[model samples]
Target: MNNNSTGGLPVAETCNERITSPTSNLGPQFTLVVLVLLAILMVLLALITVFGNGLVILAFLVNKNLRHRSNYFFLNLAISDFLVGAFCIPLYIPYILTGKWIFGRLLCKLWLVVDYLMCTASAFNIVLISYDRFVSVTKAVTYRIQQGITSNTIARMVSVWVFAFLLYAPAIIIWEHVAGCSIVPDGECYVEFYYTWYFLLCASVFEFFIPCISVAYFNMHIYWDIKKRKRNRLRSTVSISKRVSVPSKGNGQPSRVSFLLKKEIPSLDLETEDGLSTSSRTQTPPQVMDCSHLSTTSGNDRSAALKVKTRSKLHKDKQIAKSLAIIVSVFAICWAPYSLLMILRAACHGECVYEFLYEITFWLLWLNSSVNPFLYPLCHVRFRKAFMKILCPKRLAVLPPSSQSSLREPN
Candidate 1:
């Protein structure tokens, strides 16, 4: 066994001894199988996450259409994913295989910090994207003017990095080395459970709870607004029908339906109209129709359609947010059991009957990190398109002018 001192912990041992050490108590066959499986999974996950996130970044950078303020959040998210895969996975896979943290004290702490920070950043980015979408859809005019692509993009990028660093700062301050031999005799590093919990709680709040609430609330508001708008539209249509059905001024000529049709219906101004405006406007022109009147009616119809589309888009966003929330929540839920079991084991200095369950939970948590990239593509159309473009570039190539002009433009 090898040994070195850093923050009061022992290190320096042969890799094979670390793997087969009696301290680990893992049989040769079992240990070999676990290591093999972990290696395979890590390799696969690293490739997927790296390539998936890389495609997202490439899409944003290369496509002028995608280089908008709203997409900045996604760019940050992609960066977070890439960092996690590059920095976290390589270190973690070795540790898992060796069953010990052979890396030095500094590296261990740094890895822990990076892992937490990147994961938090990723979650926060998703929340920001949801919020941006909400604003763009609900208050589109304001979004276009006040929160344009450049300013909002820079602000969000800065905020994500700043928040990530702040979130991880506590870990650096609180982390301390604890004495333990890893499953691999050669692997040894500080394990700071106290700081781990702190990090987890902070991450859970910023990453999971806050985003979940913000997305859900906005989506609910959008839904309610849509329903209200639909009702108002139906009422307007009924009123217009009633007006059209009314007989012409006692002329007994079938009430000249064309004349009524030519008359412009009052515009439905949801933003400006109050109860008083409705009452006051009752005395306005009852028959005169002008182009401006037609334009207003057309504008209201467009606005109503836009609201419906916004509501639909928000509903999809809500589902994606909910799915991500569930992913994080399930991670916490699944991991909590084992963490508690380990804590009990440490405190009581006794064996726990739920070792099997603990192992299952730990593996499940690992699976969470592995599966997120795949889930993202399924939940997001942009990500899906990016993935397809990456996988089959020729298929996504721009068409000739004749074909291109015919394709519906992106809003």
Candidate 2:
């Protein structure tokens, strides 16, 4: 019995060494608490990611109002995030907790493939959404009419997935074979190319740099275009008011221009009359231009109504673009650290960068997936209503038509 007990001491000491090695930087109690907290946080994040994205998918399917061309990109994003929650994050939890790839080589390969494909798809979907918003806003007249046509939108969404797959799947699938030996060790699972500086730089460029640049450009233009449109609207309102306002021969009050009644200005909105009073307040007694005839003119009412409808459609498009901009901004924040660290990891082969920083950045990337569901509802009223109705149908009160903002594109 003594001999046996003495013999087991070495085995016990080896086990202790193995366990302590990974946590040498922190106290044993502190490490335990950190690991436990991480495990809990990760579990919560995974559940939220799945639930939130699932809600988005359900809302999109049920709410016909959300089936517009721009929103299809959102649906694509939700699907990718849903897959991340369902497969990628959950699969990674054990690896994170144990600090080993205990799930075996086959599962590791499968996890890596799905993880890269879905995440890259998610990034590409964001870029697509940004580009779509740009086109819709800058070319509102043409793209507005094409919103109902599904073919082009479908093709774009499909291409995002296909491109994402081509970018990462082929390399992940064949890297071991190409290298003629497995670079990943027996108990570890990571992309073998992380050690290759050139590939990392190229991947970072395609995945992070280009997308960031494109989003920034699109968003900047969208902002400028929106501002320009508003400025033009104000100027048109001012010019039309000036042209129509003439001094009455008797009371000195402004009288309507005869030509305005003789011909229809299709761009003229009834709202222009409201602006006339506001603009006149600074210079003279508030003179309300008589726009009653403008609404009653032959075919002018139809034209003005059409103009109002188009303007409203553009307004809704602006709102949607703003929401997507928030999404893109969030993505940049979450991804920037990880992307920079990846380049560092590649340049130094993990010598300069701390492992904890890499792990934090990894979690931050996943955090974006968790955050998007909340963001959609917060930024977009339509999505909020849909989510409320779905989650608490009985509790949801019917909204008046005036209160309900329809996100549908104009027919």
Candidate 3:
């Protein structure tokens, strides 16, 4: 088994007693089958992780509609996941199957650094996405106003990578030398401080616990904000319609209809001593008909247009919030088990948790990378259409350019 049960060199340590492969007890035939299956599964995960996130990056690059400020965070996430598939997963496959770190100490250190950096950056990007959605939901005006500013988005993206690197890179690099000895065996590679419960606690808190908490809090508020907005919008729309349609005491017609008529109707005829003034009626211009028609219809038209606009805007915001919530949820699910197990193992000095469980949960983290590509399309129609357009341009040729632009998410 690898040094870390959590899969990556960043994960929890597997003690000496449980270093044997899980398939050791099985018959040779069964073990071979299991190994073959595991190899294929891991390879597929690497491919999926690569292509899925790669597609996102590609789509973002080619599609101007997806160039919104908020999407830059997603782009950063895809870049991290892509690196995972491209570098981390591929490197780990050889060590995992062979049960030895033949890749050398230098490569192991590099792998540990790259793996932890990408994984931590992925978590940070998720936090940023959640925070962005929360702000867009609760403080939409401010978020929209700042949408045009590219520097802020760029800074946030850079900070995610920087903070992620700072979180674990220094410790991973200097822990062995600082401690005056390496905990890792000659044939395996893992963090030297796996036995340090304090370090694991701190790292886990920053890595999984804090990110998960922030995302949950933000998404909860987002849900509440969306619900409140929907309720308020419905109430306002109903009240406005009621006010517009309510019968007037004097005319028995809607007050708005009476008001429009009073304001728009022309005084074509004047009262003369005997009766109506015929000459004044004759001088009434033809534009009177057009003006009267416009006054009455324009009010209704404007009301309907405004209502549609408001509904569409709310729907778009809700979809975005929903998509972000799903992404955060997936991140939590993928990382939480491994993170908890890691902390538990660290606290117990690697005795309490089973090796197999750690291995299982470790793969679950990588599963997040593979699964993320599909989740966006499942939750977001815009991403789905954009992906479809990229994948099957001929099929979507019938769709007008206006339709594509209309589907663009609001910044």
Q: Pick the candidate with the highest lDDT.
A: 3
Question: How well does candidate 2 score on lDDT at residue 94?
Answer: 75
Model 2 Cα lDDT, one tens digit per residue, 163-220:
8998878888886565555545566777656556677778878888899888888888
Clashes of each: 5, 0, 0
| Cα lDDT tens digits for candidate 3, 1-411 | 444433223332333224533323323333777888878998999998999999999888888878888778878989998999999999988677776677899999999999999989988988897798788767665676788899999999999999999999999898766555555766677776665677788898999999999988887787887787677657755644544453455544445554543333233122222222323333446555332233335445544654565566667667767777787778888998999887787666566888678878988988887786677543556677778888999878877888766655434
Clashing pairs in 3: none
lDDT of each: 0.54, 0.69, 0.72
Q: Model 1: residues >4 Å from true position, as ranges?
A: 1-31, 177-186, 194-203, 244-266, 269-389, 397-409
If the candidates were sorted by their TM-score against the true structure, best first, what order would they fall in? 3, 2, 1
Model 2 sits at a Cα RMSD from the real structure of: 10.1
lDDT of 1: 0.54
| Cα lDDT of model 1 by residue, 1-411, tens digit | 222221122343422232222124332335667768858977887777787677777877776666666666767878887887778878876655554577776687788788767766766776676677666545655666665547657877889878877875564535332233332223453334321343445445665567657766755665565566557656765655555454444443323443443342435433222112222242346555443333334444544553454345445534644654554454455345545554454333224334445455545544444455555544555555555566776765764667534432243
Question: Distance (Å) between predicted and true CA of 304, model 1?
Answer: 11
TM-score of every model versus the real structure? 0.66, 0.78, 0.79
Q: Which of the predicted structures, 2 or 3, would earn the higher TM-score when compared with the native?
A: 3
lDDT of 3 at 314: 67
State the local distance difference test value for candidate 3. Answer: 0.72
